[model samples]
Target chain A: MEEDENIKKLNPVEMKLLTHIIKNEWKTLIRGKWVIGYGLIFLILTDTLLRFGGGGAEVLLSLSNVMLLFIPLVGMIYGILYIYQSREFVELLLTQPINRKTLFWGLFCGISTPLMAAFVVGAMLPLGWHGILAQDPGASVMVLALGGMLTLIFVALGFVLGLAFYEDRIKGFGFTIVIWLFMAILYDGLILMAIFTFGDYPLERFVIAATMLNPIDLARIMVLLEFDISALMGYTGAVFRQFFGTNSGILTASGMLVLWLAVPAWIGLRVFKKKDF
Target chain B: MNNYKPIQLHLFGGLILLLLAWTSVSEASASDTAADIVVSPDGPVVSIQEAVNMARPGDHIRVEAGVYVESNIMIDKKLTLEGIGYPEIDGNLEGHILIIAADSVTVSGFFLKNSGRSHVRDYAGIYIDKAKDVVIENNRLDNIFFGIYLSATERGVIRGNEIRSYERRESSSGNGIHLWNVKDPKILDNKVEGQRDGIYLEFAKGAEISGNRSNNNNRYGLHFMFSDDSVYRGNTFNKNGAGVAVMYSKNVDMIDNIFENNWGTSSYGLLLKDINDSRITGNRFYRNTVGIDSEGSNRVIVHRNDFELNGWAVNIKSSSRENQFTENNFIENSFDVRTDSPRNPNHFEGNYWSHYEGYDLNRDGIGDVPYRPVRLFSIIIQRQPESLILLRSMFITLLDTAERIMPVLTPATLIDEKPKMERIR
Candidate 1:
């Protein structure tokens, strides 16, 4: 029975209902103001701290990396947690003519817009306020492109988190925080301890793999190191120098961040497609 | 009469149509081509604010040479303010000259000075707040509290500016250039001096600080905290109270810089505190109290540098771990390396210790005997600090010799296994 349910084809009517559901989700996000406000405050504060706080560039960059996970996580909670509470809107959309796939993409795009806006505006601030483009226009462009991709990845993550617990808002919120905490802080701490314990021998190779797995680490390696993989080719950096310290490593890491966005989103769509309203 | 009437009517119609087309074209051109306003003797409005008022989007404002006494000049339009002959701008009582609220504005070639002092608030000369694509370059700032402040501003190039603050009595003052919540900033080739800190960064990302001179500051030449993933290269820091302090930051690369003459009772060429996963390579350190004093620093690689005439080459304090020091030259220093505690988690190898007295028996360029960098007197001085006054004394030399012979009083972990008998280069 489970296998049959898994293989069950969506009829035209169900597909249409799914499309309506996603469309309503998108509309709801566009009309909301929470994501914009959060992004605005974050950008303003980050800029202030960097410009006048007497801290150096490394501190600011690292801080920005930690903040990357929060925007999408919060956006997901706001988008998905309210689905059940949005009973009338969901019912009204279900009564329309659309498919689940359409609904998934529509909802994804709808909720992702504000997050994307926040990313663009936030990213643009560094380019202008710092005037990095005037010195190296090429680097500024590269940062912008990377910023755009990173924003999309985070926003898609929100969709997955949102869909995973549309049924239970509290559990979903808890799950998002856990995932963020694991990725941002706990995972690295555990990796460092492991390295210290077993790192008497040549064990940096394993540490490199573990660091690359974390999105925050990968993003940092890709951006801060830029294309100078040779600089990373030292004792501890040798492993990073060998892997993400190279051209192939940068490409692979970027591909990984993209996968992080796509896989979760696909899973969320699958769940949303089968979810009974 | 009939011929005249037809000709007159046709001519009148043609004239009317011509006039209509001419007016339409003029309006179209006027909407597209914005006005260029000059802020000097040539044009109206001697102050920067007046020029800002006259400017529309996509306009250029030229500022002439003269001391313009103003504060909080708002730039709300996309314009270029190119100063000729470096106009002196003094920010009296209120702070932050040329506050940019609009994007794509350029403030270049101005001698900015005398910003307002505030204990509670840090002020700036050219403050770009929440603006984008701003260029602040080739400007001279004197007695400025904070120069080229950035907040949430991106794609900025703070290049070729001479920023210097006077020696203020208060600790809160100084910082030649500052950045906060900033991203993708290129702070290149700027000379900063006489401030509490030459350059400071916080919560910024994707930044490159290169080819800058930071000297004669009361505090750190370059101070970084809680930041990550940044590159600093080809910068010279000299004669500061402390040279380059990096704290609570990670994934950083520092290369090809000279750290010199930062001498004090307690100071270093570079101070690494709670730093992790960083690379320090090809940097020269000379005539400083301590070269690279690291505390609670982890997972760092220090290699390929010249250390000359420093009081102590490297000082490793407590809780520093997993660091490797290699391929560095330690020449003419009173002490090569010293530590406070008896135990150390770091490893040192392949460094050329000039004070190594061991003979190379195997002809493999490596000394047969292990080189002890930390002397008993060095440890005692580290503990009592005041004992440093006895440096180079005959008594301390005898004590060091005794400790070297016995190897009991000095920390067992503070020895270099493969110290080079001769200099590599």
Candidate 2:
């Protein structure tokens, strides 16, 4: 009964420090020059492409190219680097009377929130300025939402990898690069080979399932569904339209994305709780 | 203006004299007194069928403006069936409104509607069978199975008619102006919409189809099968299921027509299948899925035409050969040329492609370097259609650039050696 009282008394102080940690992280990221530089890069890229891309849909497609290729890479690398750099700070915090769960949650929120803010501010400024968001609200919202989700998912993945191998920084960095490469490039190649090998089978269900397995493919199919150019897509596109054309399909895809974000973060939190400083 | 009035008066008097002499000659040729039989609601002959039955050869049946519920009004003699102020002929959704079984017949200025829809028989607003020198003109046909049908007829003229139907499916609809085994039919100044095919010709020879507007049909705007030695000029075909299909025909002259906005998976602005010796000149094909799709066609001269903003400017299949694509302007198409086979035998020369990047060093009108039109990406798309989603992606751009530099996988023979340096104006 005395131990329970002591633990209850320590919870309020840790909760107070959690907010402080979050605020400090936000200020640090905002004050950094790289945040503004990232925003400027996105603004220029979107504006220049919009000026020359001939159409709104074309511009969005080009932006999607950048988003799919670079967002995960940037998110994953940033997550690992930030966690690794803040190892001393985390160690210093552990020496205090704060609970491990509170520190881990505080750190996770700190790192991911700034990265997400950077991405959102960077992407939304140009899309809003060019009236792309207004012209096609559904597609623009989808693109932004998918980009944000990818940032969160990949960041969580980076965190999990970082916490799992906290002692070896190089190993953590190497794994992050390999994961990004596998998800972005090699996954699509494997899908193509599988489709060609199973060409004769009725592979619509299998194809849809496989797309859900890769977050990038899911995002691409979602955007393609919005474009409504099914004529170009001969048959598989017809299947995608048939499935994703409904409200249920959209709901399910979003639910899957949320679950994707939650699973890795949950696993990372568990690992952080048990890991030695 | 005041001095020309006397000359104008003199010209009017001469024209009146000519008209009187022409009427006398026509009267003498008939060799019988042509009586004007008026059919009104209160007249002795209250129905058009009775008037047509009472009329003899070389007679005139003037139908007064009233709702005449008639079906199967067969004319078996040479008669002039004229409608005064566009009389309404309601078939009561039963059968054909009028059937012309005789030669030298004229049925004009009537509003025909609601011919019966039948699968066993082909119902029409005006059906002419085995008739020569028939004139079915200035008629308004609505909600019909077939608007105007001419079968085994010679020297028929279907002019100045408006044909429309509210058919949603191709199986339930019929052609607007359907001709079978006809010779020398002059189809002019007609507007057709919402039918299966706006104008269909089968086994028709020496037809002159001009000044017609056909749009929004369930199938081809203008379809031809075995209709040889025909001419279609100054017509507009727009937004049909497939714009126009000319198959199994030879020596067809298609000039100065406009085909626009025929967009679908397998649609084309113009489809030439098994056609030979055709001349498609001075036409505009704009915004179609495929501007022109040719299969099993040979010796086709596609000259001085404009193909703009289509998915594929020209999709020529392997079976097409000896076709000359010369002096045409291909502007802003997704792919300027797409072919199934790797080898192209058709000649593509002196054409201006908007995407061509070659330079002219000698200040001549032609580019020094040849332009290869068939891209390796298009071949990949043909093999794997789902790769179309990767269109304009960086990976696709990289692959296309690599293929362009290496000249591998794309058709080597499908090059324009004499690409025009400037846009063909």
Candidate 3:
């Protein structure tokens, strides 16, 4: 009777917030046929590529390339557009008996969960059918986890940008695209130039630090290390092996990825708290 | 006619008398004092030195099964030193166990061990100096500075000997079979391991090394310097610091040898430096860092060899030219060919590459399109080694595909015009 009383004494506002987020996220995902269509396309492309290319590790590598290029773009664009399209809906929800934190989190989860679900279902179905998980569980799991982390990070970043420029949809979408472009393409080019420009000094530690700054390079290095091509890695690879070879390195990288997730979401929530509807 | 007959008869009589005198003199010398001296613990002669001192030229001294702590036992006459039951000759870490300085010497069936260690001199288990027609066979040498040292010796046969040492560093250990300024030495069926080099030949000519298994040495399995007209066949060299190195030699034939498991940062199956007019054929190089690292070598024919799972099947330096690589099977290597320079002067034809993607349009057992083994990424790696971490990346793959479609960065001349459609068995 005491346990039952303690359960009944829970905050009703939290319960209502959970239910509202689940209901809204589900409705949005069902209404958007393009999301389901893109998911099916991803599944077919991964399956076909795996079937034709060499199996297991090669498939994981190919999928990583696609994820690094397409996932952030899809997540960011969908995030900003969802926020703009649901502006009236969010305004209507704000008139209800809920706090700003609950409303912000509900909307953020409502937008991000469906995109994450689409990616997971699209990628995991093909990967499971091809027995990639059985062949190389470590690399497969790492690739999937990295993909998930990238989706969350970019979606949260999209929210931060969307909430900051709430009045101008063009500016919000434009900033999201630019950030994705910078992260995916231009960042690696700049890193390569830096490494080449300062080729004389020992740049092992510097390269590792630079890779951590970009999540895509971090995921790429993690996958490459799993391939055990250290013989071709030369000196910098040796340094990476010495450092990232331990469990501590993996822990640090994972923690940093989590931090990448948390910081943007916190900033987006702060922006939501002060926004004038 | 009569005068010629008398002169011929006199010449014949003189020849017969000379032959009779020679026979009598040889018989007298053979019967005079060249006795079989037996040295045993219970025999009249208990020491080998005493037996050797008491013997004359063409005599046989047999040492029985006992530990003879003797060093610098010089054989200055045409003598036969035979061990009756594999006697142990210990040098006690002093000097060479046995030294043969005369011609027609035979030292066989002994267990020789523990020669002195000196940086100044190469003490050996069996040292042959300025000798000809010397046969040093059926002996086991252990824990010696040099196992069998042949200096200024010719026509020496070193066969069926096992030489080993326990030295870890190359600076302190000597070679198992060291030949210096020797000619026509036949090294056959010797098993050498755990030495500086399994076999070292310098300034030697017309040597034939066959059927030897050299493994786990500190330095090279077999090293040759300025040794010309030498042929080494049917040898197995495995897991050495660096496999067989042939430097500054010409007209050498390396055939049917198995060079395997020599994997390190700077190791190779066979390293050729400044070698010309050599034929390396029918050999198998498996799992080496580099199968054949050729530098400044010319006119070499590398044919019908199998290179499997090596880091680089053939790493040819730019200084090497005019070499022919034909009918070789390159299977499952990380990189088929890595050259330092973009300009290729050598010929690579009719080799079966496992990564070849071209089809045989005319059914002639050769691909219609030529195959380029060197990738543009490999060129990038040559410039910036750290860029290898980006291997198999999308951007690099795109760059490679673009370069392949339009031959831009990779050298156009480094193509195998006749790649084999089927693997060469």
Candidate 4:
């Protein structure tokens, strides 16, 4: 509601300028052929997985594994590289008398939306074609929702990195890869280290908090909780007397994920507004 | 002198009538020695105990429809106690409803309830001891400590009985059909629920238990120890605290049974411990914590069974050796087979595993490459169960993929050499 009022406060000329920039971003994204290619990759992967990937639920599990590994990597790399490649375009836009908020929202939506839409639609079309939508709609939709949230989150983080290292492109690329590697791999290693370090004390709460901190881990947990409930259920009380993937757990994870999607982008926007470039 | 003569003549008349009644009973059947004695609420014989007292060996005592508040009604004669209209025999929280101490006794079509619980006594709706050729069937026992207790009996038939109780704790509850030191017992077509163990057997040999639905019990649906040469076929055990457990038994045949939805930390569809030379075939184990937990079990032939959606389909411990698993289908379990030790002596062949990614190139039904059932994650789980929280995580999958290419932590020899290309129906 507050956002709408702020948009309403803008005059007709500013509104036209905002819409014009957003339109230009969308046009270039479509003509770039990245979204179509991204969609095709998911399409073939999902189709092949559905056909030969151990019948029904096995296929879904394999697809989720692939999506968890690839979605964030693609989203972040594409987000940062898009900004680096389009630096001249951004500069040219700044020369025009446009509002920075309008430019920020335009760039944020322009890069994230196409990738998110391509992923969700590509993953969904094959499932519907195979009647998995009617068969097990809850799990299927949950997988897609997790993928969508992951794309938004990683892309937002990408924008933050892109803006932070605007002066040095090589440093920006190096940091983005390191960040992805840390979030995806090293974070888990750190968690294991902590668990082993505090093996005697009840470190279940610490482990869960650490997992929730990583957006990729949160997404993977959400998808696995839906598919492999029984095995995970066995783990819950068989060792630690803690619960995993309850309805409340899913809700809290999603709330954290929404924060993940917004904070990094908000930080990037703040930096953009204050920069003297 | 005249009064003595008259008394003697009356005694002589009574003796002649007794002889005629004896002759009539002998003319009925070759071995029959009595007549049908009807006991009703309004009849001369008002109670079942009174009817049993008056009946001779091989007599038929028909108890009509009435609530007979009785306890410890002992049948010492070889008689048939038949309930005509489903008569109720309420134990009134006292003790055993009926005790059969004689062989060739048949108790059927009775509604027995409320045999009081006691720590010292093995109270039951019907307690049979040291009897042979006994049949207890077509009865409904409710709120019993032990539904039907048989001990030191031979060739006993306990069939077509529905036993139910309300006790939730195993310490307070007792088994539905309790058999001990019995031989050649036929337990068939019974439904037992909410008991400690649905059907329990110990020191029982040549027992044939089939067509039973033992569900939702406090402990195992069917539990047997030291029971040799027992056959469990066509039984459905569901939602029990632990599913059917067979321990300290040999030459056991378990066929065509369904064990489902038994979910607990230590629950299993079939827990075979210290069992040897057993045949487990044609069974469907679904959605349990573990399908078959083979611990200290050996020489068991596990064939043609369907294990689906379990935490671990088959958890073969290191102590269990020389067991053969063939022509079975392991589908959609989180881990197909898990073990702690890497030294495996058991054989897995011709089973269709859903996790198997091997292809068949020779146009044969079996795959060319061997499929390893044990994964690296399961090994980690066995050692550090806390790592189970990382189930389905990317690290575990990557670790498993790397280990599959090079056998390191998992059981190196535990591979299904002849994996089926397609599911075995």
C-alpha local distance difference test of each model: 0.72, 0.83, 0.82, 0.86
TM-score for each prediction? Answer: 0.56, 0.68, 0.64, 0.79
Cα lDDT tens digits, model 3, A67-96, are: 878888888887788788889988988888
Better of 1 and 4 by DockQ: 4
Model 2's chain B TM-score?
Answer: 0.90
Give one digit per residue, the lDDT tens place, for model 3 in B1-425.
67699889999999999999999976774573443677787877887778877888888887789888899988888889888788998899998889999999998889999999999999998999999999988999999999999999998899999999999998999999999999999999999999999999999999999999999999999999999999999999998987889999999999999998886667789999999999999999876768899999999999999987676789899899999999998875656788987699999999988667678879999999898888777787677766655554556666676777688777789989999976687
Model 3 pairs in collision: none
Could you arrange the candidates by DockQ from highest to lowest? 4, 2, 3, 1
Q: Cα miss at A72, model 2 (Å)?
A: 4.5
How far is B120's C-alpha from truth in model 2 (Å)?
Answer: 4.8
lDDT by residue (B41-157, candidate 4, tens digit) is: 888788999999988998898888999999999999999999978999999988899999999999999999999899899899999999999999899999999999999999979
DockQ of every candidate: 0.01, 0.14, 0.08, 0.29
Question: Cα miss at B223, model 3 (Å)?
Answer: 1.4
In order, the TM-score of chain B in each prediction is 0.89, 0.90, 0.89, 0.92
Highest lDDT scorer: 4
Which is the leading candidate under TM-score?
A: 4
Reference-based TM-score, model 4: 0.79
lDDT of 1 by residue, B1-425 (tens): 68699889999999999999998975664553343555675445788898888777887777888878998899987888888899888887577776888888888899888887778777788888888888888999887777778888887888899998776553866688788888888999999988888889988787899999998888889998777998999999998886789888899999999998876555679999999999999999876777889999998999998887676788887689989998898875657787877887888898887657688878898988888888886666444332332333334555678888898978887778898866656
Number of colliding residue pairs in model 4:
0
**In candidate 4, which residue ranges exceed 4 Å CA deviation?**
A1-47, A77-145, A155-176, A196-202, A223-239, A245-277, B1-70, B73-90, B102-111
Report the lDDT tens digits of candidate 2 across residue range B26-47: 6664454444687888877899
| Candidate 1 lDDT by residue in tens digits, A1-277 | 6456546777777666656555665556557866667667656765664563322232243334434445445544555555545556656666775555665666666566556667657655754676644655554455445555655665566556666666677786787778766765566556545654664566555655675676655665565444222113211334444564357776777888788677777787777777776
